[model samples]
Each structure stands twice: as C-alpha cells, then as structure tokens.
Target: MLSNQSEVPSLGPIQREQAWDQLQKNEFDMVVIGGGVVGAGTALDAATRGLKVALVEARDYASGTSSRSSKMFHGGLRYLEQFEFGLVREALHERELSLTRLAPHLVKPLRFLFPITHHLWERPYIAAGIFLYDRMGGAKSVPAQKHYTRAGALRLAPGLKRDSLVGGIQYYDTVVDDARHTMTVARTAAHYGAVVRTSTQVVGFLREADRVSGVRVRDVEDGRTAEVRAQVVVNATGVWTDEIQALSRVRGRFRVRSSKGVHIVVPRDRIVSDAAIILRTEKSVLFVIPWGSHWIIGTTDTDWNLDLGHPAATKADIDYILGHVNTVLVTPLTHEDIEGVYAGLRPLLAGESDETSKLSREHAVARVAPGLVAIAGGKYTTYRVMGQDAVDLAVDDIATRVASSVTERVPLVGADGYFALVNQTVSLGEQYGLHSYRIRHLLDRYGSLIGDVLSFADGTPELLAPITDAPSYLQVEAVYAAAAEGALHLDDILARRTRIAIEYAHRGVNCAEQVAALVAPILGWDAATADREVANYCARVAAEIESQQQPDDEAADALRAAAPESRPELLEPVPVSTPVQT
Candidate 1:
C-alpha cells in the first residue's frame, strides 16, 4: 500500500506502455474513450466496481468543452422551467456529494443573487421558484434562499444599477474548478487501478465481424499506435461523439449539436458584488460569477458550426455579453475591463428545433453497435449520473457479474480529512507561518494536500515567494504542477493546471518565461525545449487575443486556428538533460 503522498504508486508498466505492447496484450473488461468529466467519472465508476478499466484521451484531461464551462456545480435552474425535476434532483445530489463528501477541496458552495425587477409578481414568482429549487437535493449543504429588498440587494451589490431590481433572492449552489475536478476524478480513477493515459488518441475501432472488440489508439505525443481490447467500449467523447461513432460505421440514435458559450473575466474590483449575479437575457441566461480576484460574466448560447478544436469568441459575442451585463452595472463594463475571454462548446442532444439554445442538456446513451456504447449530450452538473448510466449499459455486455458502482459513497483523494483541516485553519496557518486567509485559500484548493505543498516550501524557502507577475499564485505551485501533476508542457502548466492563462492581464505571457525556467528541471527539459514551450504558450495566447478581436465566429476561428499548435516537435525524443535554473 502507498504510505505517503510523494510515493509514486505502481499501476503496472502495461498501463503506461507503448501502443505496440498494448496491442500485443489486450485483455480488459472495459475501454473508455474520452477523459472529460463524464468519461473520467465513468472510468472511476467502472473500476471501483472491480472491472479492469483503461481510459484514453486524445489530448490533456478536460482539454475540450469540460475545461471551458461556466464552472458551476449546481442543479440547472433553467431545467426547472422545462420541468425536468429528475435531472435537477440528481444534479443537486451529485453537487452535494462533490461539496460535502467528494472533492470538497475543489468544489465549494457559492451564493447567487437573482435580481427581481417587478415589485410583487416577479418577487413571488422568483421566490417560489427558488423555494422549490432549495428543496431539490443538496439545499441543506448550504444556507437556504434569503429574501432581500431593493435596498438590501443594492447594499450587497453596490455595482448594480438602482433600477435593475426591485428586490432580490440569494440562493446557494456549488462551484468548482471544473478542469481540475475532472483531472482529480481521473487521478482518483488511477488511484483505484484504472489505466488512465492522456495524449492518447482513439484512432479507430477494432471490429470483429459485427461487434467492436477493441480500439486502435494512437499516441498523439509520439507517432506510435496500438490496439486495446476489452469486452466493452464506451464513447464519452462529448462534442466529438459523432466523429467517434462514424469510425464504427454506425448511425447514432441521436446527434449532438455544438453550441458556443463565451465568458469574459474582469477584475473583481470592477463589479463589487459579494455574491454572484444571474440575470435574464433575450436569448438565454447571463451570469456574473465571482471568481477568485475576478468576476466571470458570460454566456451567449448560439449554434456553432466552426472549428471544434478551439472555439473562438467573436467580437459580436463579447459585445452581446457586455451589452446585456452593462444594462444592470452601475459602472458599465467594456472590452477594456476584460482580462480574459474564452469560448466553449456545449454538446446538446439534437431535437426537432433548429435553435441550439433550446436543445436538451439531458444526456443520451445508446448501443450504436454490438459491444460499443456511446454516451453524449449532458450538462457538466449531471456528469456523474451520465457516467453511472454508461457503466450500467456496458455492464450487461461483460460476461462476469460486476459489482455495483460505489462512487457515490467514495470521497475523492483530497476529501477524506478536508473539513477537519478546514476547522484547524488557524492552527495550520500558525504552523506554516502563513496568514489564516492564505491558509483558507490553500485549503479550499488542496484540502489535506496543503500540508504536502507546505512541506516543499519548508525546505525550499524560495518556493514560498509569490509568482513575479501573478501575485495571487505562488511560485511553488508552478513547481508542484511539474513535480506532482503530469504537466508535460507550458500550456498544461498555465492553461489547465493553473488559471494563469485566463486570470492574468497578459494571459500568462509575461510570467511564461519564469514559470518555464522554474519547472524545466522537474520536467527534464533542455534550455532550448524550455524556450520553445514558452514561445508556444505565448503564441497560443497571442492567437486567442487576436481571435477575440474578430467580428464573427468564422473570422475568429480562422484567426485562432492560424495560431501555432501547442504540440511542438511531436516526434522529438524526450530529452534526458535538465535546464540549469537561473
């Protein structure tokens, strides 16, 4: 048994073997494709149930739509309008589980203020809606909805226009670092003996007559290829579900349409609100979420048929969000206030309607072919339920009697002693010679894992210094990303492992060199490789910034697509030499 967090546990060489070895010996219960939230959860669900599972992703974990979501873990309040009680309840239960039992470190309760414009009718209508919302599944995890008059609401949100609301109702929901949560789920799956590998692409399906016997995987990092055989294969590829299904030569029961949602991040000082704000828009809902040190305002839902790899936010999208949000802001937010802009695609299941906004967020699972099960089209909140259902479908195909999913009761790796650690924040702060507020920040991000991070700082005093440009984050965290997390490239460190890419004014361009210099040794990168990585990351940032300036999605996608691919020198052998730290 692994005794310490630093001790790298053995998951068998085959789990990390080349594609040839995988093809040579392929005997598994299930092979799950995709490493998004749903896919990662599916792997954990299957593995915990005594199934020998292998999970593969073409890129980094949560590299697709999962990482680029609104990053909330709440029951869809809009779904209540659709009268989807079951979806809301299941999502709420999962949210509670995430916050209280599993991944408490990554998921925390966030309060939202729903502003009411009309005096009586709107107030009661919203109050009753929120009342039913509070009764859903995880209402007790946080404080119940509170009624506030216009004066009270204005006091809480001083940045709001006085006339925007007659009253307001504040309610609770969970928010998460969605990408990190997805990664932790994959790591948790690995901890439970699931063979999980990122940068591995599912090239094709291995068909034995009418049934899919296995998958042909290509190592996108290197140019190697292999085939992994399993009793069942599940497709949880999110937006890429249709492409995966086409490989098997089968018509899907349902199609997934991509809807692009864009968010703009501005400094918290710009919108002085203690709680997040939700307002109605002509097309859909607009949320001004309170992110750390910044507020995330967004989401324009429109059909996107452009590039799927990196959805670009057009000038029009930004203008729409800013225009709608500016309607209520006392100090209007313009393009200048935006520190970062991101666009993500939501895979909504196709319906008779052409309107992408009205498409179903509910997931669908179908046996496209014998031994092949595909799950697609779900909101991030209901990923666990989608995972459970996928695993249930795959279970029947297996010859052996598999155990039931125990994921509901299982706390994620960092969650076991989270509450106690949080309670001891004062003591921990004193122990580490840190302020209680800083300790609270660390605990919320890492939970008991904070101790392990602090241990590194205990020895290397230099690691405790905050990053040169981004003072909100410490330098040691970047080092930790290389040492602990499988951060292979500079993009992986800044973009996914940390929010420096979106959180910074320069979008991590200014801090890229320093971060690369610090992490180069840990990653065994030569000076040249380190420089290349930093350059690639800067180019990526430049591309995104340039893309957002375009007037339309088509033009924006072209501009963004022109950016250098993050994958540099794919065939370049892994270097053995390390860069000398300056």
Candidate 2:
C-alpha cells in the first residue's frame, strides 16, 4: 500500500497549540509523561488500541538517553555471557520486527567483526554463542555468522594490528538514527490521534481520594500552567523516574539507578574496515559502529549520581575509550582525531549488585497506585515490549475493555512504500533537480514522505542547496525541522532534528547562524529571538566541548549544567501540590 504524503500528520506549531487546547478541554483515557522511545512507543500502543491518549515532554523529544544510544538495534551479544538468554531473544525479536515490518526505512542491516585474541578455546566458545544467537531470533533477514582466518580478517580490516587477533567472526546487527527514530515514533502516534506536545512539564499530580486523576502541566516556553485530566497517568521518564514518582506523594515499587554511557564520533577513514568492529572492554563491550562519513565508538558503563539532566563525559572517559580502542589499531587515534562526543544515562532498575555493568537490562512495570503506572529499565531494542507491558498493566485501571497491542503490525509513519521509493531514486532525483545519492538520502530519512520535506523548497529553490558549514545536510532539512518536525529552537534543529552537532568537528558552532536563519520564519522567531537562539546554541556547544575536557564527572557536569537552557522554565521547581485554583 502506498502512503500518501498528505496522510502523514504534521506535528507543526499549529498542531502543538491544538494539542495543548485539547489537553485543557477534553479528558483522556491515558496521559503519558515522557517523550523518549519507550514513552513514544507506549503512546503509539495506546493510540492504536483506540485509547484517548496525550503525551507531554519537558524538553524536546529524545533530548535525553534515547538519542545518545549506540544507535544499534540487535540482541545484546555480550548478554549471552551473562546467560540473560530471554533478554537477548526478546531484543532480537524486536530487531527482526523493525527490520521486516515496522521501520524498514530507519533500521538497516550492519555487520560487525568480533576479533578473537585467544586461539585455544576462544573461537569455538564464541562460535557456539553466535550460532545460538543467529538461531534464536527465528527467521533471519541478515546473513548468518561467518568464520575468517587471521589473513581474511586482516583483509577486511587492514587498520587493525596483525597481532591483535588470531582470527575473527563476523555477524550482523542493525543501526538507526536514534533521535530521529524516537521522534518518528512520536509523530506516528500523533498521526493516529494521540496528543503529543514537547516543552510541556508535568509539575504535580491531580489526586482524587487516593487515585491519580490527572497532572498539572506547565508550558516551559511561556510559563503558562494547565491541568490535564485523565483516567490513568503513565511515567516513562528514563533516569528521572524517581523524580516524577515523588510528585504523586507515593513511594515507588522499585528504585531506578542511573548508569552513564559515553560515545565519541570520529571520521570513518580513521578506522579502515569493511564491517563495524566490536571489541571487548573490561566493564562491557565497545562497538565501533559505521556511520555515514564517520564511525561512532563508545560506551563506558559507569555509575552516575551528579546531575540527571546533563550527564557529562569527562576527559577520563575519552582517554579510557581511546586507550582500549588504540590497543587494536595499527594507527592509533589521538584526541585531535575526535570529531564529536556525547554522554547518556541508562535507567537501570537498581539491583543487589553494586557494579552498574552487572545490573539487569530487563524492564519492570508496576501499578504505583490506582490510576497510575510506571515502566523503567530495558535495552533500546526492546522498547516496544516495554510499552506493551506498561499498557497491559494500565488497561486494568480503565473502565472498559481495551484492544490488545497492534503496534507489531502497525508500521511507523514513513515505513510503507519505502522499498518502491528506493527503486525510483534516479527518477526522483531528475524530478527534483538533485543527484540520485541526495534523493536516496532523503528517501532513507523520510521514506514516502520525502515530498513533505521537498515541498519546503518549492517556491524557494535555494533551500535545496547543502548547508554551508555542514555540507552533509541539505538546507531544506533545517526548514522542515521547524515547519513540520516540531523543532521550537535552534538547539533542537542542530542537536536532534539533524545530527550536525555530533557529525561535524565544529560541533554545529559555525553553522548556528545559518540554521537559525533558515528556521526563524517557520518558528515565528523575530530577529532578536533568532539571534538569542544562535547565541544559546553556540554557548551550549562551547560548554559541551569544555565539559569533555574536564578531568571528572563532577567538573564536567558543572560546566554543562551552567550552559543556558533553551527552555528556561525547565529549571523551575515542580510544585509538590496541585494548585487549588486550577
């Protein structure tokens, strides 16, 4: 079935205002309190179930942990060592679902080389685990694991030191633009009649006797307050789960601890490999995943307790990753080779183990109280399962029978007709006066809705040109970000809507003015407001760059947290009690 560009809902500024009005005038069956991947999935699930649902976010969509992921959708291969078979299987199942039916456009197959350092028992032991992994997920869309000799492995990856491994095994996984995927999920929910609004903070709970009746939300943009009534409220805030629960005046069933993960982005030429590389770290596995024109390497699993909003990556974090990755590379990478850095927190359910890496990735759902539900913990690959579980518990609070989850069958907004669009790339390029490669890039990002993005440049043909400072992106993307993708500020465009902030070495500083100007008219920003947006984005980039130079988390966080908030009211204290007047 073809997906008409007009059929996809536009979460533009007008729709955002309409959503806020709907929240005030109509009561909902469910109100979701976060806009991350899990929360977006939950909203999609509830909407597809024919539930009256509304979603609110304090910041832009995927501004937290959801966007900073390793950008992979796969069964955690390392989890096999921990014997968390069920977790791996469930994640693999979701990965297949995304690859085949749900989000074929966003999730694509990627190969990784797992280098073997020991020859004795290592190859066979690792081979057995991979064999099980390949079989566990049922039907396979990617190729099976392939064994390679030391010479063959080196042929695939000549950048690796010859002495680093005796042999290698290459397996398949998937990668995505995490922030874009999360936002698209939320957009899909919006298309199906769910109310999704960003920059709206849930300040306090509306209580009726002992049950949570609704929430009091503040517009972080203008400081305007409104009360939204719902039969049930769901808290899917990742690391801030406890903070949101406290507003209900009830103790949570399980505590969530924050585990910080960091990643660095360097040019793809730095690592000369046909397939992505996966190396073993002392705490966890490190993945050098291939990105367009770049390679993303990361993820230090460590405990973080300082600031939940802005988790900082210290200089030590970079040095640690470089130290381990350098051990295998023939041409080692220095700090100057790094292009970008990011840090995100994992909302792990606190367990008996003191080590963050030892904590379980399994999720938990609880009826915190009558008319309220909370879901936390889980890998990014299994977000759909987490959403389904959370909604199943929440249906018990509803007055009527709700339909089972249809999300497994429901493809995201842009998934349908994507393959057909791929076959027409050359024709599309000719029609749009662009190259086939640029057309394919748009198709990959927007799928059947590529026209929606291209339409922005209809009257203004200049919008079709590449961004000045960040040439990888088109100028129209910045315009589409504000016009239909719900980007309210310059930071949203630079950081999430487009990945210019992380993909470029200047970290979006040099192009701040151009992007701000491109988006100003769409966002209704005056010259002064546009200038403020550019300045704020520049300061944010400066702070992040400085923070990455700090020696430790404490110092890094202080530097990052001191940077200006695009939405200033997010820093305001959430009221403990519902207002008597509202």
The model with the greatest TM-score is 2
For candidate 2, write residues 1-582 as lDDT tens digits: 123446777878998899889999989999999999999999999998999999999999999999999999989999999999999999999999999899998998998899999988999999999999999972299999999999999999999999999999999999999999999999999888899999999998998987999999999999989999999999999888888887777778888999999999999999899999999977899999999999999989999987887899999999999999999999999999999999999999996489999998999999989999999999999999999999999998889899999999999988988999999999999999999999988887888889889999999999999999999899999999998888898888888989998999999999999998888888888999989988898998899999999999999999999999999788554333323221
lDDT of 2 at 528: 95
The pairs that clash in candidate 2 are none
Provide TM-scores for the models.
Answer: 0.94, 0.98
Supply candidate 2's per-residue lDDT for 513.
93
Candidate 2 achieves a global lDDT of 0.91
Largest lDDT belongs to which candidate? 2
Question: Which 10 consecutive residues of model 2 have the lowest summed lDDT?
Answer: 573-582
lDDT of 1 by residue, 116-212 (tens): 9896688888787788888886477799889899999999999999999998999998779888788778877877777787777887778787788
Per-model lDDT: 0.82, 0.91
